[model samples]
Target chain A: MQKQWLWAALAWAFAQSAAATPTGDVNAQLAEMQARITQLQAAYEARIAALEEKLAAATAPAAASAAAVPAATLPAPSRGGGAGAFNPEVSLILQGAYQHKKKVAERQLSGFWTPGDAHADSHAHGGDRRGFNLDHTELVLAANIDSTFRGQATLALLDDQVELEEAWFQTLGLGQGLGLKAGRFFSGIGYLNEQHPHQWDFYDQPLMYKALFGAHSYTQDGVQLKWVAPTDVFVELGVEAGRGQNFPATEQDHNGAGSRALFARIGDDWGVAHSWRVGVSHLRTTARDRERHMESELIGEHAVAAFSGKSRIWLADFVYKWAPNGNPKDRNFKFQAEYFRRQEDGRLAAADEQGLALGESGYATRQSGYYLQGVYQFTPHWRAGLRYDRLQSGRQDLGSNPAALQTVDYRPRRATAMVDYSFSEYSRLRLQLARDRSMQGLTDHQVTLQYIMSLGSHGAHKF
Target chain B: MRRFWLVCLMLVLSAPVLAGVKVLATVPEWGALAREIGGARVDVFIATHALQDPHRIEARPALIARARAARLLIATGADLEVGWLPILLRESGNPHIQPGQPGYLEAARYVVLRDVPQQVDRAMGDVHPDGDPHFHLDPRNIPPVARALAARLMQVDPDGSATYQANLDAFLLRWQAALRRWEAEGARLAGLPVLQVHRAFGYLFHWLGMQSRGELEPKPGIEPTSGHLARIVERQRAAPARLIVRAAYQSDAAARWVAERAGIPLVVLPYTVGGSPDAGDLFGLFDATLARLQGALR
Candidate 1:
């Protein structure tokens, strides 16, 4: 009986409120009076709350100054000399994947020159093994060092080893559209090179990236200076000088800048829907006895060869994005393509297993490759992408060196497609398939199921 | 060639005469308010339009350029632009507009906010720890924010202090009169139950004494699922709301479906200035909003 009365009263109140008027009925009038009283009470309460908040707001600055007195008495932060505080914005990215592929004896790119041990470390290739695997777990910490500078460090943990992927400091208050960044960092040469692997739309690195810069692209201990033009169109020019210890440039003993890069980018928006950016860059470095291994048909054995001299690469990249009314929350499309041409001019020497030099040659070669990809977000959560990568052994001159150092006439290429679904901004799951023809006389059908998740600290999206 | 050089020289000579305090606003509402307060003493640039979701804005290079050149930056704050503004500030390399600087002003700091979360977690879906940043819908919240903006403008451009003060006083006088007129006209709208698309209109309902039946979204920042829509439909049958309401920027499919199933009128409010054809300025925004809500009554 009590429940029935409660239901009847609820129904009557709903009816009265829906009517939104003071009615002639006595019961309706009483309900309306009760509502008016409640509204008055709420108004008074809100006024009191507002008064209290005003009092608090008035005293907040004094309280803040008092708190600052205590904070000044505390010890200073340890890292980044003369920094402000120890607090830093931190984030962790966890990535894992499952892979299935037809087993191939060697996964080397056949037509192009490759380092012997490039793929020996499975973790370096983003867990390319046949079963379940855990990829790199990236931990990032960033903070403003002081009034003039800000610092960030990203550590990649794989297995039991921790690698410092990037640790750099950038100027915060440099006027005239000028900025400086220094320390170990990725060279901003191409659209994808500066972006971390976790931000990739696909599971694995592109064939062009892998064949050109190994698994990781153009990471170096360097200093960079960039200037952005003050014009309406976005224009940026940058130069980097670094101690190149990674792929394409072997580490030198005494380096007063072993490698250098110059890049220029121009971008603008077309109306409210389209945006585009185009860039060109050049990287020149020296390789000191970079090792390579190849099968020698003449000797019927694997011969070790070394290239020592200058290596130069030219790159051009373009990216275009389209969304309705500059809003990408629902549906959008992105197209990006990068092309690279590399030339090596130096001496190539073939050696035996006992370190005996068999033959030497004055080697000069030019190679080129390009990759283009398009990604479309059909719905709020789902996205699909297609990519095609092709590489050409443009020209090779082995000279009198052994046949093992000779370049084949074949071109390497691959086609890949992927679909990913993001549960939120923090987590995404993807399924990708590719037909790989990167190696000679091999067509390996590859499949990957991957998941990437981010914890703590929201990252701002950059374009 | 001589004429071109003469024109260039003239342009260079006149550049300083055209200079004013450059104000960069993260959204159209703040941009409109800055204009009303600064009048002829300031130049304003709005980063996002009313038809765009402020929370989902991307940090484009054009915004960075604008931010770099601005003397003052006005934002809603309380994490409303967390996804994009931080990047703009960092990449702009302009110290004047960084957080806590004299040129930076966050409007939420001056206004009373609603729906501050007790415990923040991702399970709740994109919760702002400080409070709701959509306090502009409540006419009462404007005076405080306008006063703060005028003070900030004075600090950024001290030469225009008197002009800013006079403009702010005139705006406040006009705003208060409009507020009184709105309250008198909106008296009949009291006690109306509304089903909302998101928590975008919390302060609007609070000011007007309207009851929210529920949100279409299961959680904040999450898309409405069919399961939650069905549940809302079931509840509507038991305690029916008078109308369904949504913002002009939000997708209307969910609200339309609910309105169809529940047999209620759906009213789309101009969430900010320039959100609709009728809402061309700050005054027009609220006028159009109130007019639409009252239209749903019939």
Candidate 2:
């Protein structure tokens, strides 16, 4: 009986041991298979890396490597800088073009100005190759500070620190079509004028803007409040104020009445697939013209024969925009037209007691311009546009300088056209041609090709 | 014209009186959550709908009026509404559902994240690498999500706290029970290797014990390219890819290419409420997603 029980136990033990062998065998086989797979993966990845390295190696040759490329032209990775993926959005647009024109061999000049040594050296001259220049290094920051507030800030290299360009804050909560924002922002004036510095189609500012508002593009540091009425089918009103930094002394930061400006825009976004907006803005500036005379070595003596002081320079602009914002692929048309006129008082020309006009009224210009631009979509990724700009102005109101006194030769109306292809929401390449005629015997035909590339989580854009 | 005039008058009279539970859901993030919690008890209007991205909602006239009449407001709250939500709320004039009011519920209360980036930066490309508001996706967190929701619902409708509690408890029991069954069944799919378009599956995979070998996108928010797809295909060729997952709103191009090249199945899931009525609510969304994946991969 003992032997029989022992035999049964031995049989059971052997059976249990036999069962464990297959499990171990299977595990070993699995482990071997996993090791083989990992090896194959490493080899495969190495091959991919080698191919990529070879491809990159093949594309390294280039032409005209210039450091003058504006930093703003390149869209750098900006994901970690902002509030979100699209915040702190940074884009750089680098444009290098070889222009082929018959007119003039690109004029380039170099010079340096000396300060306070004015009497010592009247002639200081040196020469070198007309090297290139980096025209822009625009930086932009846009974010929502916790859903309740959002804003945009930009700094650019275009104006090259003439204390030009701008920065501003915005308050954007309006229940009705009325939104209220107060800050040192743009004067909601022209179409492309208020866009971020890098968003311009070309590298140059419009002649109309430079001639009238100077290199700053109509920007100043002053508080502006805007009210956009509800999206009713009829009319909407918007107005702003505070002094733009560049307004002349005749246009002190704020005219006596708060640089008071008013705007009224009315239109319907619903029509035969049309949305039209027409508005007018007028500002009654408090600018004063003062005359300083050659009156005196005597502290108490006053020379009174000079022209008196007077507040003058009232500005008005009638603006209009027709945009079709409801297109599937942004294949829309925008027709913008604005007429800018300034009225001045007699004190502007009455040879200030100093034998010079208190105001450079001769540099004064009255301008009317309109742009009819239409964009057609070739594909979701590509768009082409044609733009016609016409600016016609009468002779200078008063020739501040003798050049204008020679003859009030107004500039011939100017025109520009452009074609662009977008690679993605953050990138595009454009080809543009512009013909401009200005008042100072300057007529130039410019053709340019530009490429804007954005890299790494710059965020999302609808287009 | 005559009927239009009469309808306007009717709308005006009915507008103020509909007193039907006025609720505002901050975004698509918690919009669907609020709807599930509110169930047929309230009328919920999602501040941002499913058509466009939640990050770029415009402050329009309709949104303000809707917010002004709301009695309860649910938001994602973690700086997600920085762009346009503030503008709408301030203008809405409804004092009942202000930021600190009882009617407010921030859905992020319950989630525990893994990749909450220690340091935030803008250069590495919109780093929410903090592993944000996406926590609502995991099934394990549903208990906390439901409880937090119940607390907020009781504050707005104290009269229905019992009903809300009972409903939450019932839902919890059902979800927990269903979760157990899913785990049992999903055991078959343990270590199931899948390819996804984004990191959206972090929670789902964590719950199911599955593995996502890799993603198609070069980075979390970056769009996928053909090159990335081809690389994924190479891996799929080595180890047969079972499924390729994508969100409904994302471009199906990447998913399609990978699945076609790898000879695998591509599964599209709704990432938001109202993306499709089939996956309308949270429960339906999970059910449909599981069925599709199980049917195709399992």
- For model 1, which pairs clash? none
Once superposed on the true structure, which residue ranges of model 1 sit more than 4 Å away at CA? A1-86, A116-125, A402-404, B1-13
lDDT of 2 by residue, A1-463 (tens): 3335544765575456557676577666556656765665556545543443232234311111111111111111222335546545454434334343325332211010011122111111101112232344445555545434446565553433422244554543333434454555656554444554345555344544443443434454565555543333334355666653333223343343335456554443343234455556655444343332222222223222122122222233322222233322323443444555544233333343334432233334344444455555544455665555545554334334321222233444556677777645456777767765543355667666666665432432211
True contacts kept of each: 0.34, 0.01
lDDT by residue for model 1 over A1-463, one digit each (tens)? Answer: 3335544776676666657754558686767767875675556545543443454364311111100001001111121214433669889999999999977655677777765475445435464468888888999999888878889999999877898999999998687777899999989898888888888888877777777777566886989998877766778889999998777888899748888999998887888888888999999988888998866665668777788998899999998988888888878899999999999999988887678777878888899999999999988789999999999878888877655554677788999999999998899999999998988888989899999999988577678
TM-score of chain B of each: 0.95, 0.81
What's the number of clashes in each of the models?
Answer: 0, 35
TM-score of model 1 (CA atoms)? 0.87
The positional error of residue B184 in candidate 2, measured at the CA in angstroms, is 6.4
- What level of docking quality does candidate 1 show? incorrect
lDDT of 1 by residue, B1-298 (tens): 9999999999999885487888999999899999999998889999998768888987777787788788889998888999999888877767788776768778776555688888889989989877788988988887766766776787777778779878987898798789999998888888999999889999889989999998998988888999999999999878999999998888889999999999999999989998899998888888999999999897
